[model samples]
Target: MLKEQFKQLAIGVAAFTFSCATAKAATTITVAVTPTAANAIVDLVADFVNANPTYDVAVVGSSDSLSKDAIVAGGATGPYDLLLAQSYSVPANLKYYYPTLVSGDPFPFAKDTLVLYSTTVDISQGIPLQLQAFSLPDPATADPYGVAAVQALGPEYLYAQGQSLTIKTADAGGSYAQVAYLGTAYGFTGKSQICTAVTNVDQYEPGSFHHEYVLGQDYTTDIVLAGVKIARTRTVDQETALTAFVNFLVSAKATALQHHCYKLPSAQ
Candidate 1:
């Protein structure tokens, strides 16, 4: 009876030790990202998690808004392990406004091109002033895609300074506006948002017959997507996880996923 009790206690201790080991191996890395990358990271995190069973990725916020949140929280990364945006603005702001939060130089992972897409109007001739243009991403916020669209559309189409505008606002002509998104029927958006199967991923690449919409032009502007690590308040586990994820963003595995909606500088 004494021997049996000792054996049972040993087994229970071993099982508890195994459970602790497994729990320690699991690490979750949170990323603050722009709209496009937010959707793209779903596939990316799946692949990353597959490769490194111990790690998982969670996403939150626009690149600019999240940075503002971090600044408000103090010179820290806040809740995110990384920041991925459509331009250099995230790192640039952190560098000038809050340098201590940054871990290293930001790196571009993919290039997205702007295109005029329309399901309601024939856009072959370009910029149908008849319907006018709606607000786009705020250029003041340094959204590169919105900046490109606003710049290419010129003053006539730009109606406001922020995102999500109505036709009434476009008619009023406040300032500059973003064309792509749900509210506007016909407007400019990233090529990656439309591209599904094509592998080349050039900025000017035409959409295939399967596309639900019509193209206005060959292409407009090339937008770059960049990511950076946040150094402050990082744990030993996150230090390893962040490095692996950043390296993976630029790796061949991520290249194909990014190419689904964008072009790499080397590929271009």
Candidate 2:
């Protein structure tokens, strides 16, 4: 009878140990996100945080600073458990930090399309009064949407234009009125940048004329609200965690992307 009791006790201890180990295995990942799309994914992250309680998020920035440079410069020292960068912004300089996944592609979370815009005054009769006159963002190092926007404007036209109306560069909070009043800025992102610019212009121009053209993918949204110009982006290293997050976003109860004016990626 004593031997039987000892065996049962040992089995109970092993079972308890296994359960504890399993519970401890669950982990939360941190994603470094740009501003344009962070709004959307943050909702999803909130749900994950609420459900799991162990996970947390730290938003980095919307554009420029605190982006690719931070990730590349800090490498593993950066605060992120995962890096969310533009498809174009992925720094070749930090190739050493990324790990290869055996079978899955980097999950695309949102998209933003850059547009060619002018203050409302620039438009008369619903057409641009300036007649093919505008400033464009620099394609080489700025936003991908901006780069593509410049390309959409055509190389010959861009080269021949003599670069007038170039808005001055300013930190993120320079106020939209300040940017538009500068008249020209070469580098820009998509909607957020333009929106900021418009806000600046509106302060001064008030009903300023603005026009926009779709530049390129700024963020990849889930399929539901995919039409919005900007969407957040993020990636995860753990396949299980990544899959769980994806599923959570798509799930009916936590349809965070759809709620945020962006669509989720189509199921594959």
TM-score of candidate 1 against the unseen true structure: 0.69
Among all windows of ten consecutive residues in candidate 2, which has the lowest summed lDDT?
Answer: 12-21
lDDT of 1: 0.53
Which candidate number maximizes TM-score? 1
User: 118-158 in candidate 2: lDDT tens per residue?
Assistant: 44344323223343434443344554543454455454445
lDDT (10s digit) by residue, model 1, range 1-268: 2112122221211111011112353366777766555546655766776787776666664535555576448556476678777677666677667777777888888776665555445665665655544434445545565556666666644443333242332110111112222335555555555454335533322332112222234324447777777765767786787789888878776855554565565455
Ten residues in sequence with the least summed lDDT for candidate 1:
12-21
User: Number of clashing pairs, model 1?
Assistant: 7
- Residue 105 displacement in candidate 2 (angstroms): 4.3
lDDT of each: 0.53, 0.38
